[model samples]
Target: MTDFYTVRVHHRQKGTDYTLKVPDNRYILQTAENQGADLPFACRNGACTSCAVRILSGEVHQPEAMGLSPDLRQQGYALLCVSYARSDLEVETQDEDEVYELQFGRYFGKGKVRFGLPLDED
Candidate 1:
C-alpha cells in the first residue's frame, strides 16, 4: 500500500495555490496534473528547471533532478517533475530564470569567445 501525503503548492507566477493528495511512490507533478492542478512543466525527465520549487516545509526526494544542484537541493530546491513526496509538503514555485542563474550563471559568459572556428565564420 502506498502512503499518501498532502502536498501544497503555491504557484507564484499564477498566484494560485493547490492542495493535493500525493502518493509517496508517484511523481508530484504527474499526480498534480492527474488531479487537475494546472502547474507548469517542460521536460518531464527532470533535466530542466521548468518545474522547480522551493520547499517551504516537508521533505521531497528527487534523485533524477539533474537540473538542481546538490547545494540547491540542500537549500530546499526541488524539481517537481521528478520529485516524490516523502512527507506532507508545502512548496512554492520558483522563478526558473532565478534558479537557473543561481545554478549556472557563473558558467555563462565568463571568458573571451573565439569566433574564428569553421562554424563561426562571419
Candidate 2:
C-alpha cells in the first residue's frame, strides 16, 4: 500500500501556496509539477540548487541530493528534485542564488585564473 502525505509548499518569490497529496516514494517537486504547481527547478538530477527548499516542518529522505552538503541537509535544507517526504511536510521554496551562495560561496573569488596555456621551461 502506498502512503500519501500532505505536502504544503510556500513559494516565497511568487507569493503562492500549493497543497499536494504526495506519495511517500515520490519526489515532491515532480509530483507538485505534475499537479500544475509552479515550482522552480533546474537540473532535475539534484545537481543544482534551483529546487532547494527549507523544511519548515516534517522530515524527508534525500540520499541522492548531491547538491547539498551534509551540514546543510542537517540544517533542514533539501533539494526537492531528489527528496522524498517521510512525513507530512511544510516547506518554503528558497532563492536559488541565495542557496547557491550558501552552498558554494566559500569557493567564489578564491581562485586565480591562469591566462592561456602555460609552457614549461627546461
Off by over 4 Å in 1: 111-122
Cα lDDT tens digits for candidate 2, 14-66: 99999999999899999999989999998998877899999999999999987
Candidate 1, position 12, lDDT: 93
- Which candidate comes out best when scored by lDDT? 1
lDDT at residue 85 of model 1 (Cα atoms): 100
For model 2, what is the error of residue 43's alpha carbon versus the real structure, in angstroms, after optimal superposition? 0.4
| lDDT of the candidates, in the order given | 0.86, 0.85
Error of 2 at 42 (Å): 0.6
Q: List the residue pairs that clash in candidate 1.
A: none
lDDT of 1 by residue, 17-66 (tens): 99999999999999999999998889999877888999999999899987
Q: What is the lDDT of residue 54 in candidate 2?
A: 96
